[model samples]
Target: MAGKSGKAFDFSLFRRLITYTNPYRLTFYFVAFSAILLAALSIVNPYLLKQVIDKTITPKNGDLLVYYITLMLVFLVVDVISQFLFIYFANWLGQEVIRDIRVKLFKHMLGFKKQYYDKSAVGRLVTRAVSDIETIASIFSQGLFMIISDLLKMLAILGYMAYQSWELTLLVFAVLPLIVYATRVFQKKMKAAFEEVRTQVSNLNSFVQERITGMKIVQLFTREETEYANFKKINEKHKKGWIKTVWYNSIFFPIAEMASSIVIGLIVWYGGLKAAQVDGMTLGLVIEFIQLSQILFRPLRQIADKFNTLQMGMVAANRVFAVLDTQSVIEDNGEEELIHVKGDISFDNVRFSYIPGEEVLKGISLEVKSGDTVAIVGATGAGKSTIINLLSRFYEIDSGVIAIDHTDIKTIKLKSLRDHIAVVLQDVFLFADTILNNITLNNPNISQDKVEQAAREIGIHDFITSLPGGYNYNVKERGVMLSSGQRQLISFLRAYVSNPEILVLDEATSSIDSHSEQLIQDATDKITKDRTSIVIAHRLATIKNADKIIVMDQGTIVEQGSHNELLEITDGYYRNLYEVQFASATTTE
Candidate 1:
């Protein structure tokens, strides 16, 4: 529904699509010239046949016949070469256009804010970049200039037909109205059918992509049969959309073929009757008319189908352009650079919400002094993570100032601000690559030695080497091969490798085995020492040594103190949470 456009055969969108050809203007001109050459050459073969038939075959003049045949062969060779150029260059142009557009679209998508991703489906975006853009290539390869060439050739054949025998040409013209009416009807039907087909194709692509990505969940929940049924239903709709186009084709093509046959047969019969009475209506002329009619009708048939291809391409273009037209990206207008940061961060009365009319972070204020470690503990939906999200500029705050080192974050360049802060989130994402690549994220400047040093600092080098291939081990997609604790260690390595001035750990040590938890605590201690660290954890015991502890409830900070100071308040929120967690741990032991 996002890219829904009823704008079939729109000239403005067509012109916009053509602008991509500017970079390859020379190739575009050559492709167009080939189409024109092919169109002009299409008339030569029919005339050569006429010359051979009337002058040579009937009179048995064999000597000149060889010359005409040789001339025809030369034209045939030129035609073949011209055709090859048209096809090769046309397709090359289309591929180049799609490639450029795909790259631009991908770069545009990369700049969008997190909210854009929250609402859009990953599969739908893939369709926009991949299959939908692929359809646009047909616009150039077979759609625009192709229809022009066919029309030009049809006109040339008709003019030649009239020159040879006006009466037969008139007879051929008589069949044109019927074919025109059928084609007009067919075009309208096919246009609607194609739009539906493209929509269904996108739907099918989205369904398949999401299913494959979540195959593990499907199997774990034993919903294979249910998802299969769902897939079949979508597949059936996709088939029906294509079938509708076929149904229209089945009707239109036969009418075109029958009309072509009727025209040829009528010319032969009428031209024979008038051959003696009418001047220039020779047997040879009738043969020429028959040949001309086939050439003309063949492209007319193609014209109808190519129009549908062009329509389908426009439909795909509309979808792709919708994403490019989106203005959902964060504006980076700051000129201030963070050449050096003291790691002092403060939020003064900041308020923000993911959705309108529902506040997630109300006018709350906090501060982290340079080199100080702070811990935020809260229940779910208490706005614990939203604070860090704002601090990192993942989302803009609604009503207050967030600053780093006494400079307003809004005035500081986004990359510069983020460069000084390292955030290790709860969910670790690793690409299917070697662990070294995952830790450094393929940053060439961070050498193997640097990664080993960072891993050693986080106390994960021995653990990484204990694996099959040491630091070079392939972790596979999303690090599924490694345990949860191992993935966390990799994240720690990733954060430490950057050597940021500030580090934020969001619940890094939750839900781990005791042995791994001890290793993680050691790694956490090593990474947080002498750095500005903000830790968000549900386990209160883990943050007992935190320099300052803050407790949040319902988007407001209700308590703030050290662990001992908070425990002094018997009925305080932090004291109650600590008592509950500590009691739960004691019972489990």
Candidate 2:
């Protein structure tokens, strides 16, 4: 069920997975050596039994018998030690390989552009980074090495049996084709059954994860009973898929056992008849053949199942490599580095779209000089937020130039470009961590004292101290424990502490309460005093005092002027929007 695709064995993918083990070549060699040693030890017991019964017991030499027994014990101890070394180090190699692969996968993902995440599923990535990578470990521990060990043991057993008695060897393996055929059939059926099983499990798990993450919506819409019924149907399908695999296993193993039992019976009967006919034949030879038969055939029954583990690793490797090979990363080829930003920002005929052929920003151009607080006011979907996104290089511009400090932003390195700008988004997202860490994002350069100072500048310091643990308080996931207004305040504090050269506020104060609005307003004034700032405000009253106001509609700027200048223009876009959005507040003030 864990294997992806269930496709024919891909040698290329297998080699790619093996590349992860190159860093531990010596350990791989040791494991291979152990497999060979274990195979050599497998036939020692049968050979010793033959020697004791024929050479010592038959002659009634007690000293020779004791010596042979002691030798047998010595080989038995060596066999146990070899087995322990083989298992422990094989598992160790599997673990180390997976650790390196998982880390590489995650680091590669970190470089992907935001557009990739907009179209990707969080749960799917989690599975690739977690469970899929885990399956690769079994390739070494249970799949490849163990299969080699078993096949080698079979070959060694056959070699010894042929040397001892060709007649006994031929008699015992007469049923080999039947057992092999049964195993092949079992493997085919199990593959299809497990594929269905995994499909059902994925459907079941995605349903549960989605429902739980949106449990608020479920209860609000009274869908608990409906979701439960849906879950039961998925669970039943999952169970049936598993039962089919179980049925195949139950049928196959017994057939193999029957074949094994028949071979042993044939061996005993033929060896006894030969013993009566030839003076060289002895009871000890028949006993040794019986022991050797079990040793040689037991792993044959399991070899097919072990091969499935290799198939799983190959399939997982294919999936992981697909992600690693994705071309969704933003090009970071810019050699120009920003040593100091002077906060001169501009967009010249900039255009962009989240989806091709549907432009979100259409030939929009604007400018904000250093130390100017410029406000962008527009209706929803008016491209106000799109401008800020392009400025931060979260998404590259489609056909225009965005610049800071009179230099093209595309010419600046991404880290250097982003380090000078801090954006406070409307819908704040905070980690499940302490307020201190959330504000600074655990950057070693930003100390707790710096965060406290930023909070004070924003007038949120007293409110933070009032929380149970002060700045040390944990916000839980997405800051769910805090109110919408509190989360916004924390986000503002986060941006303020960075001391970026350019500050972008995308409706950051839209969700704040009346009390918090005053706090944020004061903080906004203080934070935007000496910095180049662009504020996207839905509430028209918040930006009345800005040095310049830009009014946009449907991805194009309709008007630009000072607050009073735009207000006085009769039926101007800014004047009309301002009157409608804040008419009641204007009267009260």
Candidate 3:
């Protein structure tokens, strides 16, 4: 799927797109029926013109002229109504298909492994889910239905022209091969151009999204000018991609217009000569052939432009389908239903690497009893956080087994397994919503009363009520309205409410004030009282009371013991780490 080539007018891709319309098959049928009616009715206007010229006007019969005009007016009404229905249903079908695809694409993305997101750009995904899908909508609204209607109209005009005079029709048909050749070349070139355009669009979206997300870093480093210069390069590339399409349009349309003019001229010259030489070939027949030539050649000229719409749509569809077709690396084959877990966790010689050939966690083994509180202390890049990530099954380990209650974690259903575990990271993310909504995460089963009671148990109830709106306060994006310590307290309350059998806190109070730290310490005791708790912390002072402390170096656990037991060792890793890491915090406190 990654190496697939883009082919212009891929029939397989077209067939796949058609299947999405099956849900709206009845509306689609109405659109088709309306297009057919419009095509058939359109020919009546030119036929009426020929009748007025040859039968009514030429003979000077006012009564017949009035009757023919009445018939033309009736056809006009029907044509207008048919056109309206064709436009309405075609667009409606397009909107509905895109809505379904967008929902499906988002749902698929939600199931992807964390590693997929590590390599994917947010803006690139946004373009696929939003911009690209909208472009596909045009394939039906402006491309497919319109092209079909035009082709039908052309066929109807060609039939009428042949009935009027076979020789004149043949003359017009001679120049068609030239127009067809031009269109085929135009489609090929435009498709390649459209593909470039979509790529550039994704690139531009990715760059802007990244810059905006990291605006704080940009401002802190004063790299505004440098970043703006880089953005201009991407913006220019996007511009150039569109320019290529414009250049192709400029070359193709004139050639088509010229070909159309030549056909019309040929009709006038050859038909005029034939009318002069023959008896039945009247001026009325010559004029009707000329009018019919415009109808036939006009669509031919416009088809090239319409094909551009279809081509752009195909390019967008190719991108969107590429994402939809991506199979998640994490396969959830486990059918084990875990109704309850004892929270006993064991790592048996687990080896893992985020990237190939670069091991982050080497062959490591550890165990925590159902009710034990274990603290993992390590320097940056020592694989402390990786342990938590692996335990939560955010990424699969390369080798060995991770078990909960002697049952392999891989054999347990992902949702059910994760349901019994809750994590609080150093950096907490809160959505722009009421604090109560953030705590419950909109889970209808967790009522406001339940959340308030949980907050009180966690000992943050007084702090929350002190805020202007209490638990109903709007946090704004990422909880910017709250202080760092307040946000940490909110996260603790959130995790506590879940009432998980296992709780993991990674540097939960590392960068907070003493007041917040004291509150978190009080809350942490309440939350981890009976549950299996894993605390990954850089601040050694925070974990002095942990039932067991494991000191990690590089990817291996070098020491494990109680705080007093580890302190008894004169030069052990935990003793040295406590002096180097916790001395400052202890003095500050």
Can you give the TM-score per candidate against the true fold?
0.96, 0.94, 0.96
Top model by TM-score, which number?
A: 1
**RMSD in order of candidates:** 1.8, 2.5, 1.9
Compared with the true structure, all predictions reach lDDT values of 0.89, 0.86, 0.89
Kindly give the stretch of ten consecutive residues in candidate 1 with the minimal lDDT sum: 1-10
lDDT of 2 by residue, 1-589 (tens): 1244454455667777888889999999999999999899999989899889988998888999999999999999999999999999999999999999999999999988898998886666776788778887989999889999999998999898888899998986688889888877776676567556645655666677778878999999999999899889989998998899779878988888888899899988888898878575788889898999998789888886786676556556666787888888888888898987789988899988999999988998888999999999988999998898888787888898988988998888989988989998899999999999999998999998888887887799999999999999999998998998899889889999999989999998887789888888888898899999999998888899899999999989889999999989998988887777677776879
lDDT of 3: 0.89
* Model 2: lowest-lDDT 10 consecutive positions: 1-10
| lDDT by residue for model 1 (150-247), tens | 98889888887788778888899999999989998887778788878887888898899889978999999999999999999999999999999999
Clashing pairs in 1: none
lDDT score for residue 117 of model 2: 91
Q: Order of candidates by TM-score, top first?
A: 1, 3, 2
Candidate no. 2 TM-score: 0.94
